[model samples]
Target: MSDRQRLLTVAFYLAKFNDEAVRNLGYVNFREAFNELGAKLDYSPNSVKNRRDDFDPLFGHRAGWHQIELSKSNLEIVEAFDHLSEEALRAIVFDLLDESSSKQGVLLADIVQGRQAPSYTTRGVTGKKAEAFFINWFQDHFPQDNLIDTRDFGCGYDFGVIGSNEVYEVKGLSGIDGGVLFTDKEWKVAAELQDEYHLVLVKDCFGEEPTVEIYSNPHEKFSPKKQVSTTININWGISVSEFNELDKE
Candidate 1:
């Protein structure tokens, strides 16, 4: 899809959520939301509003362009995403808006293949939100300390405290109590760091009032069992002979 079409589709989904979208996106009003999103996507505010209007008819939140049939692209977007619940669609729209999200590629690929995109698990979205909350909380609570984001580096921790021998691994739980997983690398790193490694757990992360608990040297404090799992990857390829035969055809 053209970039404009993609942006329009995202805007349409956002519109379906109406006030909830504005609040979740931290916009005080719809006009501001449209302006900011339009600026981010390099489109005019009016275009965003129009896209929202295209979807408003189906949702009945506002009087939109309902006199005529939806454009083919708009109709296609509706058909693809209309069945999703608000939370599910919000996750997808958020992913699509984020240029750096790898999930965007998977979702778009599935859409192009005429397949239903896999539903995003609540845990996945909640983890991201919790991480964001922790980043902000860390900045506010520890102004003297500097945190280097190591999440993308896969360094067995999410943040490394500069000028200190400390690293922090973050975990999020939607409710007060839930299980957390650690990869082999994280476990090894925690064992090595011992006193310096920290586990920052955010509880009720998806709720209005989230709470945080920090465990220093979690490797020593808690005894977690080791569970092993295996995954297999499959790839399909044509042999040279088969390729040659096809070429001859």
Candidate 2:
């Protein structure tokens, strides 16, 4: 299948899982088999019986999810359905479905292949994936708080909360030992925000479920720090273990 079709299929399946009618069932039948569900176990049968009604609208009433399995290279990527909002995913899928190059899409384009590239850098991709994980986590755990993605704002913070004064700067690493880099502007912003600034460090971003550690007003915690360079290599750095101690939880 084409990449467009594959992405759309994933998106549709995600939406179908969210559909209320399908969710009313205990489980859904993908290949003529019943699967145990976590939240809506009783709705499995209903989902199968009302399959057509569920998907009639294309995207159904968003519902609880149990699991979603997709193939990634030689491995199958299996994750629990946990998104409260599929808007980003839907938008990405729709953009891919559109054949017009004039339109800007979520996934970045590769210069050589002229196709959507997952990410430009390995670190960048890891950080993005981790951000998505945190977004889901916040939406699920802190339903009262509205989290906004502000990474594109170049405001030294990756996310912000609506109706709140808090801001978050996220640093993601594939392992627990990686160093966190902060630009001069980001350091200035962190110092300015002080207590309102949150430094979120995610470890093992691409492994299973990523681990999150948050530090409030992290600028105050760094001690015996030194600037290695002022010209091209100017930046503040810290080890993941040192940052983990600041975790509120």
Candidate 3:
């Protein structure tokens, strides 16, 4: 499924729960919930409400668009998440929205290099928010061709713009000036792709107005200093006896 479809499915599920979903997500009301989620998902607020109304009939919360049948995508969503309890489904939604958690592996590498990792919450800009900004900006500035989301592929770049060889790596900052972190794989890919790779920075992402700065061939544009540190790595293992003892407990 496309990233947008996944987001729509999440919104549909949230709509199924109605007011409870709004409360659980920390929104004062459905309007606020729709607006916030719309921004994060790079969709219009009305679209979110439409998706919600599409699913509302199934739950019998209110008179929704009962004239039309559920689309194949909506049916798939129901089949997939129908078995989950409200809490479990909400947890899944929360995890999907918490894009910062995806950086844990990169943060570990930074720690190994003796660099202090920045707290995600303190940054005041989340990965999802930055990505949404980039998506909207790309759609506006670039050709109308598709921009494929490669985040789940573990690729160095976050998006591959169709009809071109260019790949975009997005970084979000609360302000115009701030340090951006890169993973080893991303660095290597940037060097390999050279001019084909682009570094897209979204600045002032937490503010009403966000700005986009694009650098083509970032590896050639900036020379980054590499830091190394010698540290002991610890690994813990349990034997069969220990496992059995723990299992008994």
Which candidate has the top score in lDDT?
A: 1
Q: Candidate 2 or 3, higher TM-score?
A: 3
**Pairs of residues at least 3 apart in sequence or in different chains that clash in candidate 3:** none
Instruction: Give one digit per residue, the lDDT tens place, for model 3 in 5-118.
Output: 547556766767888999999999989988998887778888888888877655667656544445545644554555567776776567556666545334323333323333
Clash tally for model 2: 8
Give model 1's TM-score versus the native structure: 0.50
Best by TM-score: 1
RMSD of each: 14.5, 19.0, 15.9
Q: Give lDDT: candidate 3, residue 9.
A: 57
Model 1 gets an lDDT of 0.72
Q: Which tens-of-lDDT digit does each residue in 104-163 have in candidate 1?
A: 546554564342322221223355667888998999999999998899897898899889
In model 3, the Cα lDDT at residue 182 comes to 69
The lDDT values for all models are: 0.72, 0.51, 0.70
User: What is the overall TM-score of model 3 with all chains considered together?
Assistant: 0.48
In model 1, the Cα lDDT at residue 41 comes to: 77
TM-score of each predicted structure versus truth: 0.50, 0.42, 0.48
Stretches of model 3 off by over 4 angstroms after superposition: 1-125, 228-236, 242-249
